[model samples]
Target: MRYDLKVPFAEKDQAKKLGARWDAARKRWYIDEGLDPADFARWQPAPHDASSAAVSAPASRRAAPAGSEGTVQVGSRFVELPRMCDCLPWEDCDACRLQAWPK
Candidate 1:
């Protein structure tokens, strides 16, 4: 039997544990690498039709709420949009990832 488990990572808590901080301006988290500050950007979202949150993060993560059907961020604050999973950042959007099931 396949055992699926869920792990939890709180923003501030994660930042502390990972030695990073949440950048609200870009809505992404970054860890201090003792180098260029710009190098510590958060993960980019997956590409998909502008219809919902960019990539799917935990709902509990504090972030901008989605008003329309277009792409939006779930929990992450500094995640980038126009994400493409197989492109660069995300190999595929959450929707696309979910759709890519065994056929």
Candidate 2:
């Protein structure tokens, strides 16, 4: 089975050295076939079994409850969001003020 590992920016070099290749479009590193995934297990997005299960399942979206605050699942894990920045209504708040907006 093929695996796409989540190599952090600082550890990209280490992952590459373990035989992971970059997929520029997806912005992730994937293990080449025949490479031992154990060498890059730390970067695996999910457990081997969970990854396979997620891939085989049909994807469907559901609206979260009103006023709910939590992480959103991306590929194999929950995506983290800042506690205060909900990405809505750019107001003059501490979180919004600290955000790095495009010039």
Candidate 3:
């Protein structure tokens, strides 16, 4: 329910006066839940274009085909590895260790 804002650096003071909160973790400005988005219309991100192709997952985290396992060369033998989850590169779900990496 959070609403992220796209306030420009030059206008950060303006957004602050309008009650936008800074999210250090995400490095973006946002209005709290229950706040009316109409008041922050100018900073809102552009609407998603439906005509553009949707991204299923980032390439590094894309899962291997069903019933197949990926193998990596380990010294002398090939080691089979499980498919990875399709979580966002910036965020981690319960299954991945993406949180360990620096943002």
Candidate 4:
């Protein structure tokens, strides 16, 4: 399933790398976490088992599709959410650096 996503600024363009796709039937988008934007830009969802209606994204994928929500590497740990601010991390810092973090 290739579902389109409306990524909030927090998620940043990293969403672009995930190649988030829209699932019209589910009316929600999906993202693949394993994908590193610096390298690739697309992926397809596993075929849903028709026998079972439950949709299960990998634990890592489900935990955080976008790093903005904070990130978990390999999903062994989850980083804390960034603070609220004009920048992506929402932290107080040189506007110059923050602006470059993500947008």
Instruction: Indicate which candidate wins on lDDT.
Output: 3
Q: Across residues 1-103, which tens digit of lDDT does each residue of candidate 2 receive? A: 6577777899999888777888776566787678987898788776553433312423445566776558654776666656556656655676676665634
Model 3 ranges with Cα > 4 A deviation: 49-103
Candidate 2 clashes between residue pairs 3 or more apart in a chain or in different chains: none
lDDT (10s digit) by residue, model 3, range 50-92: 2122123456798877766776436666665554577765665
Ranked by lDDT, the better of candidates 3 and 4 is 3
TM-score for each prediction?
0.22, 0.44, 0.48, 0.21
Per-residue lDDT tens digits of candidate 1, residues 19-45?
455545545544443534233233322
* Worst 10-residue lDDT window, candidate 1: 1-10
Candidate 3 C-alpha error for residue 30, in Å = 0.4
Better of 1 and 3 by TM-score: 3
Number of clashing pairs per prediction, in order = 17, 0, 0, 7
Clashing residue pairs for model 3: none
Top-TM-score candidate index: 3
Q: Cα RMSDs of all predictions?
A: 21.3, 14.0, 14.3, 18.8
For model 2, the superposed segments whose C-alpha errors exceed 4 Å read 47-103
lDDT-better candidate, 1 vs 4: 4
lDDT of 4 at 41: 26
Q: What does the lDDT come to for candidate 4?
A: 0.47
